[model samples]
Target chain A: MLAALPNPQGVSVCPRRARWQLDLLLLALECVDLHASELMLQVLRELQLQGMIPNRVVFWQIRCTNPFRQVTQRTPLPLAETKALTAVVVQVARRQTAILRHLLLVLDQLQAQNLPPETYAPLAAYLDRFRRNFRKRMNLQRSSLFLYKNHQALNELGLKLLAQLLLCAGTKGMERLWFSLFDGEVS
Target chain B: MLLQRQYSLPNCTLRIEGLSGQAGAEQLDIVTCCEWEIIGQNQRIKGGKDFLVALLNSVPAAAQTWLSGVKLRRSPQYPIQVEIAAANQVSLHIPRKLLQTSPEENSESPTNDEAGETLEVHLTWLQLADLVEALDQFCSDSQTLPTLIPTFHSLPRRAIAPAVPLRKQLMPLGIGAASLAAMAAIFFHFPVPERRPPREEALPPTPEAVTPAPAPTTPNPPNP
Candidate 1:
């Protein structure tokens, strides 16, 4: 998003701190990319028609940076991975800038698709939770293993499991990839 | 100076960097939803709405997906008519000072009671899918959220005398935790009663003294 700048242009002459600023900006971009947005909704309609997101899922597409064709190569990207990516970018970001950075991540994701009702619900919910659970630790804990040690791993996994639980709750017509999750739990 | 806001509604903690130069760069974004049911047969329910609303509001601000939808559903619908006209487009420039500090009016941070915090988040396709998945998940879960032991202390033994799947214990938490699994359920089926007023005593009625006098007067007149 930083223009994918050729030769760094105006950015290079600035001090290393400025370079850090640029880094923060792009990291913010990544955060927006991973989350959901309005544009992503539009992308989903297209993806469903293209036969992505499992024949059962129908249309699971996103509005990512330019490579719409490349998306189908992957299906059902783990929500955690996106979050982790955001974490990396904002490793050194402070509170308010951190907020803008995270919002940008969300905005980027929106750019990838047309936002839908279902999309907004969970997306907003996720961001709200993040501010409570993660931001403080990252800021207060200063990148310690606290998130990992205290709750992140278990919470996220549990949430993922929860997601699987809810996703299967409605889609009786779809094939049971979720059952595999349960089966894995059972076995 | 940084703006600090705490919301118990969606369970969120937000620190808006009013002074970015001083604050550090360690931010976090979390998107999670949890729901369970607590059904009690008979009980006292003082703060079900506040409790659940507090829990929902407690959800952190960085949780973009659920924040966008779950929070949105919590409020009355707002009208949004997007105009796609090309003529309306305008280029705006940001002065250096403007970026340095937002207007004082824009200073307030997100909290539970505010209508703006839960308003719809405009997002992209991937994030939307995540949001949809999260939301479908929230509705599925919120419809039936986990019923903790009905106390700040969530543990069973810690909060109440533990109960088996259907074993009926005295439930130290009282009637609220007694019969049903859901706090909301117990509340609706059999609402907690309000205090009754004290009973009053009735005194005996006075006899018809006036009637006797009138009867005597009529008898005397007839005899005469």
Candidate 2:
């Protein structure tokens, strides 16, 4: 009697469900690739080359600047670019979980290597500040960031990562200098 | 649609709208410049005092070099003024602590309400210029990052705590303890794993030969 029921094609049945599962799997893989320490290292190198020394209060001010309104109202980025900027802001807001993981990984690695506590203390303090400031931003669902159903959310994440990388470069530099000083003394 | 600009600080939000006549737009008017109206948070200071308090609190410690006299004007006649020089700092001007203490002791007094009214604030030269620039940037569409540098600075540091020497004091003691601990660990734990009976054929024949010798010696353990 069950055989009488037409056997649905394996590819055709619950296509939506299969697609959702694929998206989630892809997202998890993407998250795994987000090596925060490596990325931060690269960012620090770039900042040093550019001679950029980010002030502690700069990011805080940037955060306060209602990034959404600033991007929308002030920026002369084309409409597409504006949309992309919105998506990036949304992506940054969404990627908090992965960012937190990366921060923890950096801390764990520092401790594991028995690096001077001075090296990681500043970083840990900064990470705590970031967590406090962006905790609410992090809780947002990925869907809320999408303005239109058709807009692709691809490049926005990369942009957000770049912004954060630039933002934290100063703190990273200070930490690196302290670490080197302590490391030499220990040796 | 008239392009209005809104800038937000952590505690305060600034909104500016261009005041346009029938012929042409003149100057932008500040529609709102007030602290975030979060319920049950922040002392409920009325008038211009709220803005000054918000400005002072937002200032970074590193930027405190330029903080001078802060004068708050409610009217031309009576103004709450605080001189922030090398000696006096911004913390003295914060109305929160004053307001907090007043409610418990003098909640019923009308003078308490008058105190809030007395400290009406006015924007200094730098603050006004910053506001003007923000409004200009909002109206002019040039692709650039928002320049939201806050010139405000917190009160001068009362004292700078010296860095704690985390590893300095403990290093010598730790070196001695660590070496002894390592020797004790090697004596007690190091040889036990090699003494385990080899199960797999993958194990080298030398380990099998050594394993037999250790088994005999394990029974009279402490003598070794």
Candidate 1, residues B68-163: lDDT per residue as tens digits? 111121221212111111111111111212122223422342122244322112222222223223323333332123232211111111222222
Q: Model 2, range A1-187, lDDT digits (tens) per residue?
A: 1121222222222222222222222232234344432432344344342122143233223223232322212222222222222222223323443443344345435545776323665443443333332333332334433431221232223222322221212212112111211111111
User: Which regions in candidate 2 have their CA more than 4 angstroms from the true location?
Assistant: A1-34, A44-187, B1-5, B8-35, B39-58, B62-93, B96-224
For candidate 2, the per-residue lDDT at B38 reads 14
Q: Which candidate comes out best when scored by TM-score? A: 2
In model 1, what is chain B's TM-score?
0.17
What clash pairs does model 2 have?
A: none
Question: How close to the true structure is residue A13 of candidate 2, measured as C-alpha lDDT?
Answer: 24
| Candidate 1 C-alpha lDDT tens digits along A1-187 | 1111122212222222222222223223333344422333333344342223332233222211211222223333332222222222222122223333244344444534654212554445543454343333223333433454444353342233222222222211011221111111111
Q: Which portions of model 1 miss their true places by more than 4 Å?
A: A1-83, A89-187, B1-224
